[model samples]
Target: MSEVKKIATRASYGSALVELGKEHDDLVVLDADLAAATQTGMFKKEFPDRHIDCGIAECNMVGIGAGLATTGKVPFVSTFAMFAAGRAYEQLRNSVAYPHLNVKVGATHGGISVGEDGATHQCCEDFALMRAIPGMVVMSPADDIEAKAMVKAAYEYVGPVYMRFGRLAVPVINDRPDYKFEMGKGIVLREGKDVTIVANGLCVAASLEAAEKLAADGIDAKVINIHTIKPLDEDLIVTAAKETGKVVTVEEHSVIGGLGGAVCECLSEKAPVPVKRIGVNDVFGESGPAVALLEKYGLDAEGIYKQVKEFV
Candidate 1:
């Protein structure tokens, strides 16, 4: 069997920016002195004039991005999730989201997968924060292809967007010809009669692997990739919940106010089914190897499989 290709969604974010820069002269990128780590250096290298380094001030950078947007420029503000979503929350909520500007927040190194960076850097609450903003579009791509596609979609959407990317390289699962990307839509990767596994970001791949394990154990689990979190694919989630009668949501983020929370919110009102949310259990992450932390937090394939088996 051929080895699966892996690439960090952060890398994809940078590459997509470069590609979009070539097509749109109005596209600009700003970073909070984290161009290299956030992968915005790729855009800086290609268009030095368009890329602005705001020197570690996340709030100011967001304000600058918002100001640039008023001039009909699509500005992507790049930084770690901690800074982009956490540190600059006030500026983002007021300057960008309140005015409904065409500013994209490229938040890299989201969740516990940030590894040795520890609790301070790992931003598991970004989804909840971004989702709270009235018109904000929140997204977390599963792989390189989806990440690139999401960037394009965010750029075309013309409003505030918060895009989360991971540092860990994840497998490329959406490389099929039938694959399609649409805002506020979920993709059903596998069809089954048993429980439904809805996930995003790195957890989508893990959930898919967990579904395979469930299949081996005679549990036909369905897998759904919900890349968009703000304008969530409620219909898809509701339909899947009705079909399966039980649902499991997985994410690298905290189970509170993330994908798991969003899924629960949807199912409770529309399809009310039993649900199990697999993610960080509302505890701060400690410094550790990224893979090990995932294992410890039950975000890896084996861990998810074990949890799903137990749930079943």
Candidate 2:
């Protein structure tokens, strides 16, 4: 094994916007007073005229992005996950999803990894909220590489898109040159027959590590990275469940109405199996370091390993 490179998905999001901006002239960026934090400042610096600062009003920012979309502009809205998905959910529902506009919402600081920001800033239910909207494309990239690729893919995709990224730096798991991000498709990182671990966003790396731990114990666990949550890869999920007869879903969001809920919903309808969900167990987050928070909430590699062992 070699030393892996680590980078924040938020940083990758900023650079992805700058890279995509050069190609798409209609691409416009919007932020609500936290461009620096969300990393949308990179786009603002490069394309000043195309960027809009809507102050601290997240709702107004989303509305502005919706309005821009109506005029044939591709607007990428940026803000914290709490505000983008919670505060401005109404505007997103009406202005963006209702009309099926071409708006890309970049929600950073998603999940408990926001660290010292605490419960208020840490959004563990954005995935659930966003996925409920009709015609909404929801995505949570696993790492920087996937984050960049998803950003570009979301821009090219029509209608509304909600992309969640984290503030903490994570190891680059998909550094292979052959890697390509396809919308609504889940990528299998490792193949096994004992169990299947389906994970997204920050938990993907953790799940990979858990798989390695399981392998050492003679438990061959399959790892699947679901970058796109909505329009989830149903075939993949069903196949994994049918093949393994056991399934585990890991996420940084709440166990309710998040990836776990989505997986259970799919399995119940298609292939019923004993599924274990690893995430925040219907509780609010507290102030702590990002990694510590993950550990306490049972969202880390060790936590996942324990949960999977118990589940099996």
Candidate 3:
């Protein structure tokens, strides 16, 4: 294994868009005056004529993307998760999901990792919001590789998709050459029998580290990376639950209706297990550094280690 580099998922998404743009001329991009923040500027630089800046109007941006999709153009809409999932939610549900448009939504700065942007910008319920929309494929990539691959996958998929990207530079988790990004499939990073740690986004790296720490205490933990939130890998979750007998779900979003909730919903019906959820427990985030916020909210590796140890 080589030394891993930490990079923002938004950066990877932006680069992938540029590469995808070169191959497909109909790939259009729409941003709500947040090209730089959302990292869509890379695509805009390469294909200025194909990029559309909707100027702080997220609803309008989503509508425009849906309109473009109707015209046989693949539009990638970019904006902060707070606005993309919350502000333009109605437009997304009606114009994109309901119509089943080929529009890919790039929702950056998801969860509390938005850092100093505070509670207003920290979208803790985006996964819940996007997951509720019918025909919406919700994905949250763990690292740069998965993020980049998902960008291309979302574009290739023929329906509406919402991808969650982070503002913080998360550690590279899926750097193996053999690792492939498949929608609605979960990857098992570490195999163990005591407990299964299912996590997504930034929590995937933290869960891997926590699993290593648990190994020192003779508590073998299985770490599963669930990149796709909606249309979750139910088979993997059921298998883990049946095998491990105990499960822990980790995420940067709220514990009520995010990764933890989704896993619980699956296990409660198929294979019931004692599931411990590690995330922001029904509270808004405050202004702080990305790493600090993660630690404070118990979403970091050390936090996950403590929670998993207590659960097991």
Residue-wise C-alpha lDDT for candidate 2, range 1-312, written one tens digit per residue: 237788999999999999999998999999999999999999999999999999999999999999999899999999999999999999999999998999999999999999999999999999999999999999999999999999999998999999999999998999998888999999999999999999999899899999999999999999999999998999999999999999999999999998999999999999999999998999989899998999998888999999998899
RMSD, every candidate, angstroms: 1.0, 1.0, 1.3
lDDT of 3 by residue, 30-134 (tens): 999999999999999999999999998999999999999989999999999999999999999998999899999999999988999999999999999989889
Q: Over 4 Å off in model 2, which ranges?
A: none
Q: Which is the winner by lDDT between candidate 1 and candidate 3?
A: 1
Q: Give per-model TM-scores.
A: 0.99, 0.99, 0.98
Give the clashing pairs for model 2.
none
lDDT of 1 by residue, 63-97 (tens): 99999999999999999999988999999999999
Q: Please give the lDDT score at residue 65 for candidate 1.
A: 96
Task: State each model's CA lDDT, in order.
Answer: 0.94, 0.94, 0.93
- Name the runs in model 3 displaced over 4 angstroms: 1-3
